[model samples]
Target: MPKGYEMLPNGIIRIKSDNSMYDPWEIKKSQLDGEELTLIGRVVWAEQKM
Candidate 1:
């Protein structure tokens, strides 16, 4: 699950951690602009690769 993903009215996804939106876009719960996006089974790292 995304760190700051929240379900808004009418089913939109809002990523609070994304300080680039500047305005509220298609922020919904469990949905990414009516599309289901996931990072499951994906490898992640806290530090950048050097």
Candidate 2:
């Protein structure tokens, strides 16, 4: 399966690492207002082998 991180519709970020999942909702909340948010990250695609 492809692994990394993603920002959910609920304003929650799912971080996948070491076969574990972490939800950083609190941090996302603090960084955003309402449904609008600016996410900063480098998205690496597993299929591309980057």
TM-scores, each model vs. reference: 0.33, 0.29
Residue range 1-50, candidate 1, lDDT tens digits: 12355666775665543335345345345533456665333235455779
Predictions in order: lDDT: 0.49, 0.50
lDDT at position 21, candidate 2: 55
**Best candidate per TM-score, number?**
1
| lDDT of prediction 1 | 0.49
Please give the distance, in angstroms, between residue 4's alpha carbon in candidate 2 and its true position after superposition.
1.8
Residue 38 lDDT (model 2) = 46
Residue 45's lDDT within candidate 1 is 46
Give the Cα-based TM-score of candidate 1 against the true structure: 0.33
**Candidate with the greatest lDDT versus the true structure:** 2
Question: Could you tell me which residue pairs clash in candidate 2?
Answer: none
